[model samples]
Target: MQLQLQTLPKVLSVLVMEDRIDAASAIQFKERLRDLTQEGDQRVVLDLARVQFLDSSGLGAIVAVKKLLGPDRVLELSGLTPTVERVFRLTRMDTIFTIHLTHEAALSDVTGA
Candidate 1:
C-alpha cells in the first residue's frame, strides 16, 4: 500500500492507495503516519475512501497513532469505505476516534466547525 501525505492549514491528511490495509502494509502505514505527525499539526486525518479493507493490524496502527499523538493533539478519520467502516464498527474504534463523512468535513471539524 502507498500512503500519500497532504498538508492542510491545521491538519495533516493521509490518503491510502491500497484497498486492503493488512499486515503487509500496516508497518509502512504506521511509519508513514509517524513521519507525517512529526510535522506537529494539531489535527491529523486519515483519508480511507480508497481503502476497501482494513484488518486488525490496520486498526492497531490507527490506535497506535492516536496514542502517539497524546491528548494535546487531535486525530480524526474520514472517508471510510463500507468495508472499512464495518471493521471500525466491529472493533469499536468508531467510538474512539472522530469520524467524518468526507475529507472536507474532517478538516472543518479539525478547524472547529
Candidate 2:
C-alpha cells in the first residue's frame, strides 16, 4: 500500500495509491495513518480515487482510524469509486463520515476555498 501524505493548512491529505483496501492491507493502513495523525492537523482527508474495492476488514480499519482520531479530529473520505462507495453506503458509513467527490473538493471544504 502506497500513501502520499500532504499537509494542506488545516488538513492532512492521505492519498492511498492502491486499487483495493481489503483484508491484506487494512492493518498497514491503520498503522500508517496512526503514525501520520499522531500530533498533526485535526482535519484529515483520505483520498480513495484509486481504490475500487473494500471489504469488511477494510471498512473496520477505516472506522477504527476514525475512532482512534478521537472527538476533536475529523476524518473525511474522498474519490470513492462506485463499488467502494456502495460498501460505505450499505454499511451506513456514509452517514458516519463526510464524503467528497474529489480531493480538491475536500480540500476546498476544509480550507474554505
Candidate 2 regions with alpha-carbon error over 4 angstroms: 111-113
Q: 23-111 in candidate 2: lDDT tens per residue?
A: 99999989988888998755999999999889999999999999999988889999999999999999999999989999999988844
Q: How accurate locally is residue 15 in candidate 2, as Cα lDDT from 0 to 100?
A: 98
What is each predicted model's overall lDDT from 0 to 1?
0.82, 0.90
Each prediction's number of clashing residue pairs: 0, 0
RMSD of candidate 1 to the truth, in angstroms, is 1.7
Residue 72's lDDT within candidate 1 is 82
Q: What clash pairs does model 2 have?
A: none
What is the alpha-carbon RMSD of candidate 2 to the true structure?
1.7
Per-model TM-score on C-alpha atoms: 0.89, 0.94
Off by over 4 Å in 1: 110-113
Candidate 1: the clashing residue pairs are none
User: Which candidate gets the maximum TM-score versus the true structure?
Assistant: 2
